[model samples]
Target: MLISRNIKMADVIHMNYFTLSVLNRFGIELGFGDKPVEEVCKKHNVDIDFFLEILNTFVDKDYFPKKHLQSFSVKLITDYLQTTHDYYHKVKVPEVESLIENMVDSCYTQKENIILLKKFFDEYKQELLNHTHREEEVVFPYSLAIEEAYQSETPDKSVIELMNNYSIDIFQNEHDDIEEKLFDLKNIIIKYLPQPKDTGLCNRLLFVLFNLEQDIIDHSRIEEKVLVPKIREMEEILVKNFAKK
Candidate 1:
């Protein structure tokens, strides 16, 4: 169901608990006292429409509103994406790492395999960090520049030059399949790794891994589906105008 302003904030959480993380990225906390979505968003100074769109897209996998999401400013979208990166780095990554450490500790017979599992996850984590770092340092700034130049009546020649040097198409083409390694990690745990003595630890680790995988998938979808295409459209317009000049 598409989230709306009139929907209760707490009810939204009930609808999909994953939204709690989404709310956190928005800097929203959970003490709204039965207020509606609009009220809570307003209190938190969030863009109600954007929040609703993001929530609806997250909750209902089939409900991506590409055009609507694209209509929002690039800064708004990128800001949210950056916060998500922060969450992954500061919270999710550490949490997963700790879980893996505990899982390895709980294992007795498959010490080598568990050590290998840690090695695999460590590699994946480094790759993920590198991926997000590139976006934060390069792609996101380029995208923001494109938006700024596109909005300007007199687009800057420098930004146009930057566009000429790098295009969203190039980034899209070079986009690493980070999730592939994650899927492999999951398979290794499920199919190959001997059952850890603490079954609960094993289960918890798998659960967190699955959640992280899905979250990353959703995050990438926004970049690939919305951010890239929107920037590409602006790049075309800016280039055409620059050529005319």
Candidate 2:
């Protein structure tokens, strides 16, 4: 999509491919009514500034702040991340799996291909859930503890010890690999999936895969852009101000 200064908040998806995904990621459902972005956001009860910030970040990667995660609590972002995990596990993954099942039964000639797709999806789902589990069980607790104590000006000894043993750097290094398989899943669907006897089923599968890919990308941005950077800054502060004390 060619971006231009003329692309106002009122522009519709017809005008900007990226805006539609931005709205969708924020759970906004809109038609191409060409409504101003602020009005659309107001109708959906979304904070206009936050929505715009997200959209701008999506449009321009450099727009996201590099130095600090402010204007919201780390707890708020972490809790939202947890909700994303729940949605992925209980809703998103299951919905896509069900779509595959229906396609398998309906696309008799493509059943084998559908089966392969399902197996790949199941593997991806489990891997994602496992990743979420590690963040929830180990990283989040420690991150929040550090945040909680940092806010109180009392960095706990245990959190410091825990940080020494576990690092977000490890997670950071592994994240790209985890996302790599999903990219392969998408390309296989887009390029190599045998034509389902039912075109509708094929389209549905593609829609779900495309949406899931975009959603996962947004989720990763929240983690890498917001959570990791905030934690890194917090750790730096803790070491300098509290470590020797």
Candidate 3:
């Protein structure tokens, strides 16, 4: 992973190329976060437990902020609790609540709110959920697997090289796509919440969307700069071991 403060929020995997096939297969409008785990699992053909374990890992790492119960809304927290089976209950619920409140007050109150408010919320939820699932299930596991393969006594150099090269090429390509889509979505939202619209609801919706966008960008950076490189290094180690054999 190439660590730098340079990458902005829009340059993540959705903007990249390799994951584009998966993203297109998965579709971008509805996003992966809003759908049920079972549904996302079925759609992506990922394992549920495996997915849960990965989410739990990230949550534990505080890669995600713990949902602040005192400051956040109850309903949002409750929804997350139900969805994640309390795995993120203590950490994510509060933030989820705050997001819900902001979205309801800001985005849902606009004149155009009725047209796509529900859709927006649904997509928002699905996008976050799906993002987490992808990292935990597909991306992380493959990464860890590559790392382990590189560390084994009799490392499989061919497999290590293939996985490393493919992951880097594919994941980076998808990051570009994610960025473009997010930029388009942001533009659409901004149009809907044009300036001088001082409604309390409009303010909240725009704020929430802006914050969510920031989170997505930051998360993508971590994966690209941190996770991707880490996995590649591990693959390199495996190759070195193979040479010794």
Candidate 4:
């Protein structure tokens, strides 16, 4: 995203210990553990400048990608996207479910609407899982095939035909719809719903939704601006060559 910071690599972990997620977002492992950020970057082959900009995006919601794939690895981005999907399905979604349970039990007086909210969140989770499943099962595998084919000196014509048949643009179309459900869930909780008497429970539910919103925003941007663009460019090259042949 935006490269608003000129911070040193060693200083990043110090800025926010929780920022290790940023490194994970870049497909960098945290084997560094308590080590300096610079050492981690060096070990991971992470470009220092890229790491800070990505870190800034999470730190500040105002950050936007000025030039998304420049000097970035498509494989790394895809790996990071997959990691994010795993986090969503495993950690984020389940955490929301746990909070919903806590809210329901703690606020029995307000169980009806909270149950409805939980039902809605369940559907939302299914939608998200299906969306991610499509990416992992179809889009990503096809994209990787294209990357392999196009990178070769003599690209595979059959592979080009295969990748061309299933377009990334298809996924792009409904990305907003998937995101809209989250927005709907958040709004329902914030405005229209009958909240529980336990203010902490209500607040916890809202907080989880808020964090999910921000995470999804960054996740979508990477897919839209970085991964899709790179794959599209490769698709264009492979198709053009296949046509000439």
Candidate 5:
């Protein structure tokens, strides 16, 4: 079911606990009582439409409101994306790393295999860091700049030069499949890695890895499906307008 403003905040959590992370990204905490989603969003000063869209998209895999998401300002989208990056960096990555560390420490047999697993994850994490760093430092700013230029009555000539040098198509082409490695990591644990002494620890590590993988998939969907196309459209408009000058 699609989430509505009238739905109770607590009920939303009951519907999809995964949304707790989504709520956290919006700075919405757990003590919302029985307040409706709209009321809670207003209290938190979040854009209600954007919040609902994000929640629905996460809740139902088939429910991507691409046009609706594209209607939001680039800044809003980028800000949310940045918050997601922060969550991955500060919380998810560390939680996964810690679990893997615990698993490695607790397991006695096949220690070398576990160590190699850790090495693989470390490489994946570094690649993820590089991807996000480039998005934050280069892609997002360029997207925002396109929006600014598109909105400007008299866009600076520099924007044309910027677009000429770097376009959204370039970003889409260079977008890496970082989550693919997570799939391999999961397969390694599930298929190849011998059962750890602490089955619980291994299970926890797999669970965390799965969650991170899904989260990254959703994150990439928003970027590639929504943000990239929106910026591309804006870039096209800006180019045409500049050409008329």
Candidate 6:
């Protein structure tokens, strides 16, 4: 397997909110009441009943249990925002404010800079949007499916083995795209602003950029280093057990 082995279940699960928020932002909303398990389980080649059990566990834990979990419509798109508050406050917002400050100072004052900054942020936003979608629609759901399989009590190895076919189409591709976007942001910051010697505005911009970089790095670390491995493990185990038939 070309997949990283250090990926953890916690990583992907933690990112569930991130994906949901991203989808919500893009208007591709999903909810528990939407029959996500039925749709997603089918995509990932997992059993629906087993998948429901996992959802119920989350419900018991009150992970996102709205309307008393039981009353919560399974089809309703639950609030799935991940815990990126620290990342947003500590990194993303500061960096963005800084970037905005820089734009106000430089771009507005300088005609060409305005166009450049707009273009940059526009592209940046697009990349992020795409990244979140893949995670929500593919990676997170696939991981959920695997979690269901891994935890299943079925004695029939084949029943437990279905996770091997776990497929989150386009997840890997989107990962690459996100990595490239991070690099692009870094390169732009490095190339466009050498030093914040001008004023507090430049300093602010640099801060924002730095924070965005941190968030992405943190996000990627969670996804690549933590989530990927666990999913892969689930897949591998399922494959082996599935072969027992």
lDDT of each: 0.86, 0.71, 0.45, 0.73, 0.89, 0.47
Query: Which ranges of candidate 2 are over 4 A from the true structure?
Result: 1-55, 66-69
TM-score of each: 0.92, 0.77, 0.47, 0.81, 0.94, 0.53
| Residue 128 miss distance in model 6 (angstroms) | 0.6
Candidate 3 RMSD to the correct structure: 15.8
Worst 10 residues of 3 by lDDT: 1-10
Alpha-carbon RMSD to native, per candidate? 1.8, 4.1, 15.8, 3.6, 1.6, 13.2
* lDDT digits (tens) for residues 60-168 of candidate 6: 3332212222321112221122334333444464467456655655543464554566567667666666656656665666666665666676534543434435453
Mind giving the per-residue lDDT tens digits that candidate 5 earns over 135-197?
Answer: 999999999999998888988989989988999999989998989999999998899888878
Using alpha carbons, what is the TM-score of model 5? 0.94
Highest lDDT: which candidate? 5
Clashing pairs in 2: none
> Which stretches in model 4 have alpha-carbon errors above 4 Å?
1-6, 9-20, 24-39, 45-73
Better of 1 and 2 by TM-score: 1
Better of 1 and 6 by TM-score: 1
lDDT of 4 by residue, 1-245 (tens): 33333344445666665466666656676445456555566677776545654566556566554564255655666776898899888888999999998887887676888888889999999989998998888878887887888789997568856865777776677566567888998898888977678888778778878888778887777677666777788888888888887
Q: Which stretches of candidate 5 lie over 4 Å from their true place?
A: 66-71
> If ranked by lDDT, best first, what sequence of candidates would result?
5, 1, 4, 2, 6, 3
Q: What tens-digit string does per-residue lDDT give for candidate 3 at 1-245?
A: 22112332123233343333222322233355545545655666544433332233222334432222122222222233233322332334345456445554554345355345446555655665565666455555566566556546665556755674567546666654333444555576567544423455545555545654544454455455445555555656666666667
Clashing pairs in 4: none
True-structure lDDT of candidate 1: 0.86
Best candidate, TM-score-wise?
A: 5
Q: Which order, best to worst by TM-score?
A: 5, 1, 4, 2, 6, 3
